[model samples]
Target chain A: MTENEINHIFQTWLKQHKALLFKIVRSYAFNEEDRDDLFQEIAIQVWRSVTSFKQQSAVTTWLYRVALNTAIKWTAKERKHQDRHESIDVSQHIIESHQPPDDRLAWLYEEIAQLNEVDRSLTLLLLDGFSYKEMSKILGISESNVGVKINRIKKHLTTKSEKS
Target chain B: MEFKEMKKIWDTQNDEALYVINEDALHRRIKAKKMGTKSRTSFSEVLLIASNLCAGGVVIISHLLKNSGNVAALTMGAMMMFVGVYILFLRWQRIKRDQQTDVSILGDLENAIENINYRIKLSQSMIWFCLIVIALTMFTVLNSDQSVFNIVLISAFFIVGFIMSRWEHKRFNLGKKKQLLDLKEKLINEFEM
Candidate 1:
């Protein structure tokens, strides 16, 4: 396909599925500016890879794969220099900017941020209503492992929510 | 907070659906992206280019400022240029590999693995090669008045470079290469399935 055609199709798909992109961003990033940066990064990756996307799988499947991979790599790079820049108070600006109107969704993200990296990703896929098989495919894990990990995360979150 | 209740809550949320793409911002982003890829040479690649330029400069300077018949200076400059050219050739191959548009997951995985391997090899070799050229060039340029201080400084540079390169080699293997290897193996298993 030509570049314009590819751009048109991607814009259409992104219009419908932007929530998926935002959901991944919100889950991976702590604050609003970070979310914006992650959103931009994911958008660029998708745009760059759009031509390479064959319809062998669902569009959502391909998207989650890219989103998860980018998030993992981006967060890894961020963590590498976290120590050097940890003294500055970044969270103050974040706090001023990120007052989510919805408390439940905020709490949900808080819970997600508490999970380990792999579990955090699995939870995002689970919350997006992916099947165990699809989660396995996206994550390169066994189907049974996805089931086991998701169940553990669910139970842990449920217990925490109940206690609180 | 059961899974079903969580799913219901997730499905009910419309607050997040409020975000819409602004065409102007997207156009700007796309333009910025085009610019980024056009100049996507990493810091190391920039260093390689700079080193090549410096080597070429040394050859010109040797002929103009120093004794035109100084064979050692000429030979060292020539050898440095060869090293620079070889390193640039390796870097170009890496850049080409990075730009390949392979859509399949397996293809992407293999490309990532190869890129990591290329990085490991490049880091391990470039440091020693550059160090040798730098030491030789320094000695040739300052050979007229070789003070004890100059010799000590040159020896110190080599020692520091050796230690840092050794540290980098270990760190790359333990961290980046190991992670990529695990991911590559998992990807192969995934594709096999």
Candidate 2:
């Protein structure tokens, strides 16, 4: 497709499924500004790769791949930025504007946030109803490995939630 | 609750689970992004290019002075320009690496680790060459009987640059490389777990 046509398609899909992007961003970023930065970063990435979106998988799958990868790299870079003394105190900037109204969902996301980065990605994908095959595709792991990891993550979460 | 029940709750979570996205702001961001890519330069690249310009200016000034021993000054300035260009090229490669998306988390982490490795290697490897250039430039300036003010300024630059480079190597390069490696190991270990 032409560049404009591809961008148009991407923007349309982005508008329709923005909540998917939101979930990924929220899982990764700690605050509202960070969330906005991550969302823009993901959007820019999607636009850059839109022309290469050969439709090999669903558009949502392609976006999930982009969003997760961007968030992973972005978080790494933010750590580097902090080390360089160039980062803001994101803790102080937490405005509480984006908190969920539901207590369980909030607690659930808190648990997800406590996960290691790789597990966090796995859990987010699992919660979004991705199949083992799909999660494996996005994570570059075997489907069996995806199943094992998800089981472990579920057990961990169950233990944590039970204690709380 | 069972995993299935939790999945149902997750699926049925309210829109409040997500932050409100402003469509107009998003559109504006997209437009700005399109404009920003034309002649795209990262922040690091801008700093590098600015230093290159300063080096280029030194080269022109030294060449125009036309002293008998100005050859060394000209040569050092030229070397600075070359190093600047080379570093900019490397920075461009790194910027491309940073832009890589649509990959798996393993791929992303691996790329991040590699990016840091490249930076550490570049800084570690360039120290001697930089010292040589600075020393030669100072030598030429002193040998040409330049003003004491200029001589002191060049000495200050040499001292600061050398110390900063050494400090960076000692303080950041080793620690940052180790940290990135540890992070990479943690990522791999998590996947295996």
Q: What is the TM-score of chain B alone in each candidate?
A: 0.67, 0.69
Off by over 4 Å in 1: A1-13, A51-56, A74-107, A157-164, B13-16, B21-43, B46-70, B92-124, B139-193
Best by TM-score: 2
For residues A1-164, write the lDDT of model 2, one tens digit per residue: 78789778877877677778877777888776777667777887888778767777988888888888778767766445432242323332222344535677677878888887778899988988899999988877778888899999999988887788
Candidate 2 error regions (>4 Å): A1-14, A25-57, A70-100, A103-107, A110-114, A155-164, B13-18, B23-71, B77-102, B164-179
DockQ of model 2, rounded to 2 decimals: 0.37
| Candidate 2 lDDT tens digits, B1-193 | 5667667767764344355556667666667656655432244356666776597667757577755446677677777788778878888787776666446656655765676677567766667777787778777676776899989888898889889978977776677667667766766676675
Q: What is the TM-score of each candidate against the true structure?
A: 0.62, 0.69
The per-residue C-alpha lDDT of model 2 at residue B51 equals: 79
lDDT of each: 0.69, 0.72
